[model samples]
Target: MSSYELALDRRAKEIEWENDTCDQYDYRIAAFCGLAAGVIDALFVGAPGQGALGRLTDKGADALVQKIAVMLWKGDKRSSAGGRPRRAPDTLERAISYLEQAFPVNYDARYAADLRDTGGALSSMAAKNHHLLSLAHSPDLIGLIFSILDQFTGGASFLYKGRVIRLIPVKDARGNKTAYMQGTTFSSKLFCGICNWLGHLASDLCGSSSTRREGKTGRGAGLPIPFYNLLLLMNFGNFDGASFAELAVKVFEEGYDLRHGAAMAVPVMVEECSIKLIWALKRRFYAGKDWSECIPSSKHADLRIMLLVGNAALCLVDAADAAIRAAVSGGSPLTFVLHLNLIAWARLITLIFKELRIRYGAGVDGAFAQYLAAAGLNDAYALRQYYERMNRLDATLEQKLTEFVRETEKEYERFINGVNQSLNPACGTPRQRQEASVAFARRHGAAPERIMETPEQLREWLGGADRQKKR
Candidate 1:
């Protein structure tokens, strides 16, 4: 029985044991009601003290427990009263709670499961299948999830050296949970939030890229706040079912618009298939513990690489995102760069925020402001050289690559140092940077087999492709 149930039983007994039946008020109302809580309190919190109903038959036990739970629920609701002030739980917290309820895992259950296909298949789908709204501010919802996620503090342990992998369950998806240990480091969590926010925004069906511009100003001005606002919204809800595939793709195709000065490129954001592919991979993997084992370390390493490349790709993606705005208006480099750079800057904030959390802890004082503590980009020049070399080695890669250099600042310096060391001692080619770039490109799904061999030759293919699109 829950604490509420124990209280109910005691209250009932107090009413039954009433000596003064002649007068109902004389029986003591407080005595009657307080008994209910006394009886059930031990049941929920597991402190101590049992009520008369403790030894009841199983059926009666069930009934009494349910009744007490109902009363407690009612009391809890009443206690909350008309929207008083309180902090809200976040999506991740709620997700953790869902996992707890579904798995009902405890510290003793600190075990690992295969991560692959673990998402929907294993889940009973009851508690773990709710939509975790990201930025749209569901305070109560957020608060609830956060409360749930709290169950993992010092409770579970994983085999990752001394590291603990707290798996977060998928709310909307049926039978799975994510395997990645929640990187509680400020930087990791912050980046995760950014990803989550991006998801929330993208899932919003009500808006499109057009929201960035909506007004009666010049040819294209206002930056359709509504559209972007809705864009942010759609990203939170699950777009997993087959129908969303067509809808997302169609909408993306319609909204994709990027420009360079006046030179607008048609479909720069790559197909929705790409983003969908990421989610699909997530869906296919992010289950339990086994997923980490199933995916090769090389693939995992490559994703780390992709995260880097993707950030680098963002320079272009940022430009592409800007293109969406540009598509609405005629175009200008200033507006394009302004919007692009602004998002890039947001990415920078996210990056810096993430690195701080990783190096220090998120709980450090004023975590959000930690970027001020980060060293200035002393390695930007080296990174610039790296990029120039990489691009020169394969111009197509110039278009395809994206990197998150902020986090790589130290690494870039280290790489430069190593290169300098290897060169003077034995003597080597300056082209090694270009050679390294080629190797890095090959690591990704780069099938530069024919594409790199002849960019000029592909002009015919590109021409044909454009003609087909136009038709």
Candidate 2:
């Protein structure tokens, strides 16, 4: 017999019926009742020195645990009268505990299965299927996660690269707090809270200090702010407004210093930021009102086109640079990786342009048209076809990998040449070249200079007879 049964037997023997006239059967009945009562009391109040509910069955103990868990989750503040204050577990601790119970991951079982099947196909497939199923509960999971986050460390903050990015709300002109995402930076000067990713306060989503310095009152000061603010509002706040403007501004205006100040990895960062902005704009487009009114004028549109096209061109330059560096270093061919990256960029550009066309009603500004013409392309439609052909989902991976290299290289050379021609009018016809030369002369305060037949002769002449005197 178990310890309880043995204790009950001893207790039954100790029970005494004290009535003198009582029979042996009556005495036995009294002892039996006393033993039964003792066992029942032990079951109700638990055994002495046993942890929590040691006398209770497993089911009973688990039920009690669940009840306590529910009470804690519900933030029950009840305490015994005249007892010490109720010291409940913290919100994070409770949330984590609840999550563990709700989503029980059997890592040991998974590991054992993986070990048994060396290929791990069965375990991997099972994990993938389970992950897919879990997605259905994403909305609830998100809420729970936010709750946990809110409970810990005060408020909403994105932890990136081991740094906490705390966003402080900004105040507008009327003294009311405007919603903004400001990071904890050393500078006292306020930046566009949302666009401080450049790690400076000069240029961002809202306003720039450069505008104040340049004495530029109208054009560059706050032109993109309204658009970016709208985007930020749509992304993080209530979805109001009918039509949103296209988010094409000068790359430098958006605080991307790709030329003199940028690191080698900046192009990649720019590409990522561009992709993020594109997504935000897309979301705004889908949910908001009609965008016809918010459409930029031809001049602003040209700048925007330049920004987009320039970014696309830079992506090509970056790829070429990577390839050249790899070749020089005798590194393995990163052809597959490069192709995949280009394909993704192509897809993003295609989507952004397609949406812009749908919203704006026709072609992109004269800038894109001129750019295409200079690139020796008769039609911009052909470029669209090129992008679409490469981005075909039905195509095999091998085909994509092959086409990305061939097509991108061809397009890269053409676009780069076109960009060079646009920047340097000397690449154009004689009359156009002469006009560009005249403009350059006027800008540099050059006294009426003639266009020489050869640049070498012009340079030699400009050296003058005074060169010997200097020597």
Best by TM-score: 2
- Global lDDT for candidate 1? 0.32
lDDT of each: 0.32, 0.33
How many Å off is the CA of 266 in candidate 1? 14
What is the C-alpha lDDT profile of model 1 across 1-471, one tens digit per residue?
999998998676445333212133212322232232222222221100112221222223223333433333344332234421122222222322222222222221211232222333223211111111111212232222222232323222111211113333332222324222234754464355443422322222222223212352211110111112222222222333323222222222222211111111111122112323452354356533233333422223222233323334444445555566556666643334333433233343454555455447767435423432353322333333544664464455323432444447766775675555434544355456445544545544567763333445558778888999999
Clash list (residue pairs), candidate 2? 181-193, 242-289, 243-289, 243-290
lDDT of candidate 2 over 308-369, digit per residue (tens): 44345544544554455456656433321221123224434764675477457566745577
Native-to-model Cα distance after best TM-score fit, residue 313 in candidate 2, in Å: 3.6
- Runs of candidate 2 exceeding 4 Å displacement: 1-304, 317-347, 350-471
- Give per-residue lDDT, candidate 1, residue 271: 19
